[model samples]
Target: MMKNNQPEVWLRGALPDIPKLLQPAAHALLQSKEEVFKYTEDFPEALLWEKPAGRASVGFHLQHITGVLDRMLTYAEEKPLSKKQFEYLRNEGVENPEVKMDDLTHAFSEKVDEALKIFKNTPEAILTEQRGVGRKQLPSSVIGLYFHAAEHSQRHIGQMLVTISVLKP
Candidate 1:
């Protein structure tokens, strides 16, 4: 159960081993992870892919949060997406009978952990260095990519919560 009394991750003070410049991004990602689990804790698997009012399903939000983080982190490292990464992106909203809310939420949680490890190891100096995003190679910096990933995760979490509420009995 989530403890409502404690402050959000950003207010919990600086995380150890993360660079000062990257702390907010890390905090945001951590908060997103917490919110994802909290909102989906009692969500029924039967409604995981339900799209109430034609909004994106909760399952897609969960998967996209995880997959986008992976892709963004890869770009931050100045790398291209692998074949498997592209495959994941293509299937983001497609539902499978095997997928459950727990599995999707847990994947997002794990992706956040992976992101933290990258943030810890990132050199502060290179944060502002330019990097490219997507096939068009739109310009962005390391910090930009990381911050986008964090903010994007938070956005999807909010959408997922609304979808879950609409679908819940």
Candidate 2:
């Protein structure tokens, strides 16, 4: 069992103590929304979800990113989810093959904004008890969860950007 103070210690292990670097990750996550719209409806030819070695289609890639956010942020909030919903959207978020970019982008942006707004508005004291994946039994902090969610999106968005380049090239 982890001691009460151990959660912060664990979080610091995966993420460095420097909160300054996190701002860029947050910016990248926000920029991903604009980039999604820019590449899809406005400019389909722009590389947004192209993958090398013949991976998921562009549409699926976009949906995959959204699905991840939905799980890491939405599900983490303890919303009721059907078994199928948990199985497909949260579990196999990346394996699907037929998501339209416009729809995925819109939904993703909404959820991302929702979670970010919560993090921005939530009180410091109340935020500590919020649960995150794998930390349910341990009672994780909301600030850590919020940052993890952003970092999670930012990392995958970076991958999507690269995949787009490969497909475009």
Candidate 3:
């Protein structure tokens, strides 16, 4: 249950200085961050890579949450993905025993911080500006990218939570 009986982020009124057009995106992203941390607290490192019933591992969700935000935000800025970003994307789901749960969650939290900073600076006027996605150059706007980032992160968060619940023994 939400503390103080507060409603969802969108129901809480306007976020200071956030563009009106991007408010829902910001709310969703913030909500995703809160739930990701909540569900992953005390999650065991040993189960980080476990796939329950063929579902994606917790580690994959963690990495992808951070990476997608980075990639989408890059696109939202009308920039192409860097070689480094592509490299990170390639390695997202690969098992790394050296990676701890806290490390992945911390990285995700840092990405959320970066995203919030971007949201604060984004001009409402540029929300509809066109941007290309990936090498195919699929068209999308700044708002589309940000909204997708928010929804995509929440989708992964749901999957991760289920995996965590099933793996926690």
Top candidate when judged by lDDT against the true structure: 1
- The predictions' CA RMSDs to the true structure, in order, are 1.0, 10.9, 1.8
- Candidate with better TM-score, 1 vs 2: 1
- lDDT of model 3 at residue 30? 82
Give lDDT tens digits, candidate 1, residues 1-169. 3557779999999999999999999999999998987888777888888888888998899999999999999999889999999999999989988988778888988999999999999999999999999898999999999999999998988988889888988
Pick by TM-score: 1 or 3, better one: 1
The Cα RMSD in angstroms, rounded to one decimal, for candidate 1 relative to the true structure is 1.0
Best candidate (score: TM-score): 1
Q: All candidates' lDDT scores?
A: 0.92, 0.55, 0.88
Report the C-alpha displacement of residue 144, candidate 2, in angstroms: 2.2
In order of appearance, the predictions have TM-scores of: 0.97, 0.61, 0.93
What's the true lDDT of residue 111 in model 3? 90
Off by over 4 Å in 1: none
**lDDT, candidate 3, 1-169, per-residue tens:** 2233567777889888888888898899888877877888777788899888888899999999899999999998878899999999999988999998888888988898888889899988899999999999899999999999999999999989888889997
Clashing pairs in model 1, backbone N/Cα/C closer than 3 A: none
Give the worst 10-residue stretch by lDDT in candidate 3: 1-10
Error of 1 at 158 (Å): 0.8
Badly placed stretches (over 4 Å) of model 3 are 1-5
Collision pairs in model 3:
none
